[model samples]
Target: MARWPLVPATDAPKNRDPEPPEGEAFPVTSTGLASEQPLRSAAFRWFLAGQSISLAGSAMSPVALAFGVLEVTDSAAWLSAVTTAALVPMVATLLLGGGISDRYRRDIVLRLTSLGAGLTQVGVAILLLTHQHPALLLPLSALNGIFQGLTTPALRGIVSNLAAGRGLQQASSLVASARNATRILGPTTAGLLTASVGGGWAIAADAASFLLAAAFFARMSLPNLPPRTENGPTMLGELREGWSYFSSKPWIWTVTFAFGVFNALNMGVWQILGPVIANETIGAEGWGLVLSARGVGSLLASVVMVKLTVRRPMVPALSSMTLGAVPLILLGVGATTLWLAAAAFVAGVVSEFFTVVWETVWYTHVPERMLSRVGAHDEFWSFVPIPIGQLSTPVLAAAFGTAAVAVTGGGVAAVAMLMPLLVPSLRRIEIKRGGD
Candidate 1:
């Protein structure tokens, strides 16, 4: 692994135009069309339209799947078992997906994956509707995961492909806002569909959404990507290449590692201990309100980020994340429901700001050729520790008490999240307009 310089500077190649002074807005092109014209691009519009449609259906799957499983087995353990089957494959193949995405046209990768995923979902829906053998669920679920694993990295990279250069921020913010809106709409629609019709129908709806997304991808044009340079490369070789790039970049791996630790602590405490605390302190209904408020905050953040500009994006990226622990602190201290909810809402707002800035910076800074692979590694590391956190938090809470656990995790998470700021490579990454 390469060590970073102590001074704040980028490890990547210097831009032709020097970075503007700290706190100055990024140097936009004279035309400003890179930022302005992305929305007008037919390709970007189609990409957004496809994602919007797919996300809406994908969102509904969680509720529908849960209920669908219940209709078959009526066991929470089975629910966990089947869902884990899906997740394992998805996580296992993420890096491979990234490599493939980089090797081919992203639009083609997305199209195939979307079609595969849609067909798998449709199969799962049929099995569920017909009340097939419960044993089939796990295998079907794993098949679903396989498609998801193949899809995700390709999907993540496509935004950069569709909206390059200065338009990235605006493109990202628009997609982010659409995704946030769907988070509310998807589940609501699923709930109504599940109640009025059946979980099977709701799942079928999700499958249909995937098919529509695939159709959109099939029709849309993508930028001409470079031909694959490494002929007859092995999968392992390509993966190693991606990993080499990922680990060599201090900013990339440092932030990724920070997220891993923060998510471990934060997710563990939140998912495992949160509901228990709410039961005792705020009551489940109040907790629901708090969660709803958080979602609303996320929606509002997407809107705010559309107009927001950051010169040194990492400043706000890391700074915004520090606020995430506030709600945990309040929860641990036994704050009232309204207070806790208010804190959660603020945390959600800041988290979205971090998200928008982080994505913008990643695409802005990383080499385009390696974007998918680097993104996959970034996601893999960040996600790998979540289960560990979720599993261990309970044991720790049992020993130290929930309040102590929550406080300790929140404090630790806050410190870990901010640690990347000390790294020179990360601290000075600039997001500027012009030049691909």
Candidate 2:
């Protein structure tokens, strides 16, 4: 694991050249279209498009992996263990993973990581075909987690690099939109595919998505990305430096703390609680519909995200944050009401609007070279609480009752999220054209 050098004082790379006039959607030269839309380059678009399948496959994973584990082992502990096996490695290896991203061309890392994770899916699918133990998916997932840990930071860092200047926000919007769209289709598509063809085959489709991603990434002619820092720290040192940078910025820490809580609780509610909520109150079909509603909200939000620059910093964002609690709060209360479910969907859409704004904030503010490592730091801490929520949700539901648990949880989220608003670092922060 190569470490990071001290962050050089170089400015975020800027592109000032006028893009050749563009008529068609495709760029005629390698320099890219007008600077205003540097991100519209054929390479970046294809890169994003190619990653779409992979994201869809990621969305597909939870269903196949969870249900498969349940089929093989009847205990909730077994299910929890499988997820932990995957998640722990993702966060634990994240900085080293980021360093790897910083070292190689992002496209290369994307290609290898996608192919590697895809192969794990392929292996899991094959074993399922043979009716092998579902626990096998755990190791497969763990390996895939490793690859994803690598890919995530590299991909975003490269995006920051590729999408210089005005297009960064636009590029970020497209990425969010792409992710939202995939979330919409991925599960339903996976569910239908699994129902018709079995989980094994559904997983095989996930495997195939990686092949497409690899192909697309391999063909991209990205700029050479030599490391920015000279001889610096070893890999562990680099990882530490990343943490220093992350901690040094109150803006970074402030936003990360907010999301860490949000993702941890929200993810568990979705992964473990949502299906259970549906099963108890509604049905699988109802679950699909509600989840799809959220997806639709996310999709629509992402599309309009390009123009949603936050002129009013944390104050407005804070108000929205308070409001964002509605859907999840609604989820707790609204499970029995269809209208409430619709409200839940609306909440998801509205919440993501703020999420996109904040994400670009971090991206712009952080140094390009440290993007991956800093990103990994955010990811690591943000997700650390998720497994806690995951393992505990089942127990909480068992003890407190699901509905009560949900209502309480929602209340906690709203209150807990508000604290950051008072923190001077977060309150003092301002949004601008850059991701830093």
Candidate 3:
């Protein structure tokens, strides 16, 4: 097995321009539009194609699964159980997955995990189609979650390698656009499928999407670096090194911690309770439209980001995230479907802007060798609180009323989004021109 060389603390500066690894060639910089630059690389194009298709299907699966659980059990608690089952295992394995991606070839890891996730979705589709107990989706969801955890860190690291140099921001924005566009198509399709064919068929479409994405990944030709000597550090040692690097940076750790708190409050209320409220008021189709409207807003943001440059990225990134609370507040207050969709759209725009800038920060600043492992640490903290939110939200809702619990969560999340800005080091970080 090959071990990745560790980045020395002094050598890895914040805001450093990323260099291509020894074996890899820099992607040709495009003379065309900014968004077109990332498309110049055949590898990134394939990656985008696969990701767009996969995202569309993946987005649909959640709405399908959520409605399916409700259809079968008609209990908010059961919905929480299924979602929490997937999340707990994902949170548990993120560090291990991060380690694996750092230790192995990321493209290969992604291919295998996509295949694994697709197979799990197959199982989910079958269970739903056969009218099996909702409890049966738990194990399959857990299996799928494991694959997702493994996929995330590697996916984050690979983009810089694929796009390289000045193309990083372009790649990031383009990818976000693809993701947001799919969000529009996905939920709308899922709602229609669930309404007409069934949630099982929607899930089956997700399975096919994953399989197709794996095929596209197989077609990409990334360089395979030579293996390290046998005397290299053990996995535990590598992980310790990753943590050391991760924790030493106030900007990295602080932002991650803040988002962790924000996610804890936001995810549960929006995902679990929003659906319940929509079920009662607007119906499944209306909820899907609300989500789709959010996608439209995100898509618009990504387009605008393609040409825009920010010097102090984190300032606006963190500030804009406070808007994420709006949709939740609207949902809590029993706003009409149109009003809820409008609020969701605003939330989507700001959230996508934050995501694009933040990802560009990671690609430009983080050392390539350390990217996956460090990102794993970031993601682990960011996601670890989700299951807690999922499990407790129902109980909290039952006690204080769903509307009250949701409004409270939104308020707390708004505060959490601002906390990272208090760190002095985070405020000083800058993205150099042509670096993003």
Candidate 4:
């Protein structure tokens, strides 16, 4: 968020303001101030309020959607199809979305996408309420994905802008905490709504949240960006530029690649086999409790991170990620529910810790102008392996048995997380203090 100028002030365009106006939401600065608090900024407070509400709604919609699908046709295959419809478009459009964010006002991009997403959700609610054909969900889900892709990159950039230089870590931590807390509340809310009013009402609530968040975004006052010159790079050229910058940074690309491997293996085992193992040992209710424990742990970590600062973050960040493999290992070994919950809790804490630190590092080091495009690349690569894991895990578990697959996947994920440490550049990265 440090608008640490990429070029000197003397070389900046005359139209550009070196600092934010007196009443702007994010006051620009060259370096972070440790005493600054994110919540004190009216802009950040509004942003957080909107994001927290939207995240809660987002978390609820999935549960409602799943139940709605099952009610219509108790076919797991149809559910998978609906999920895939959303995933494919989201992954496919990420880079293009990132490029668009870089060329425009990130807040405006976010506002438009949120509006689109809300409208799509409204359509989904209508379809569910009408008991329409399940096939209709495919198009609706695909539209949701397109909106999601367009929104994500801009989200990262906007958070940085909201807090700017001084309160980035606190901002990231607060946002993450809201997300973690919502993960616990959202599903429970969805269950209640699905039982009483039906899935359509729950989804309708999600649509309202999106619309409200869009309104908050519209009200934010951000510094004006320089107008895009007619001779500026084309979208394709801009994408190439983003890729060039992303690939050129060893710390950036290597950590992202490592996360790709880690996410693929970890998601495969934890998402697919964890439930299977839980069903065999613990009941469905117990499995839910285990997940709830993890969410609680993540929330605690985010609170801790508000005051915690790491000078050299990557070392600890990567180191703690190894904890992510613990729950898988416990599940593979047929641990009791209590044991599994304990492992999951610890894993969640470390995982959230890594997330907070990672965002802080990016906000501190990356140039604000290119943050969205670069983040898009980072998100794109990290997400690309998810489907591979989701698809292959069940097949592997069937062939090798769930226990063996879970254990092997856990081992592989741990190694994948640690492998980035081997890169000297990654290991040596430190927070850029005082605009270094």
Off by over 4 Å in 4: 1-35, 432-436
TM-score of 1: 0.89
TM-score of each: 0.89, 0.84, 0.84, 0.91
Better of 3 and 4 by TM-score: 4
Name model 3 segments beyond 4 Å from true: 1-36, 67-81, 131-136, 275-289, 330-339, 397-404
Instruction: Return whichever of 3 and 4 wins on lDDT.
Output: 4
TM-score of candidate 2 on Cα atoms, chains taken together: 0.84
lDDT of 4 at 239: 86
Which tens-of-lDDT digit does each residue in 1-436 have in candidate 3? Answer: 2222335658864423344332222343322222336787677888889888888888898889888777777888988888878877887888887778777777788889889999999999999888889889899999998999888888878787687555677788998998888777787799999999888888999999999999898876566645767777678877887888788777789889888888888879988898999999889989988987888899999999888888787888899899999888888888999998998898989999999888887876676677788999999999888778877999999999999998889988998889889976666556666633
lDDT, each prediction = 0.80, 0.69, 0.81, 0.82
lDDT of 3 at 238: 76
For candidate 1, the 10 contiguous residues with the lowest summed lDDT are: 24-33
What lDDT is reached at residue 12 by model 1? 32
Superposed Cα deviation of residue 342, candidate 4 (Å): 0.7
**Superior by lDDT: candidate 1 or candidate 2:** 1
What's the CA error at residue 284 for candidate 3, in Å? 6.7
- Tens digits of per-residue lDDT for model 2, 348-373: 67777776766665555565567788
Candidate 4: lDDT of 43? 72
TM-score of 4: 0.91
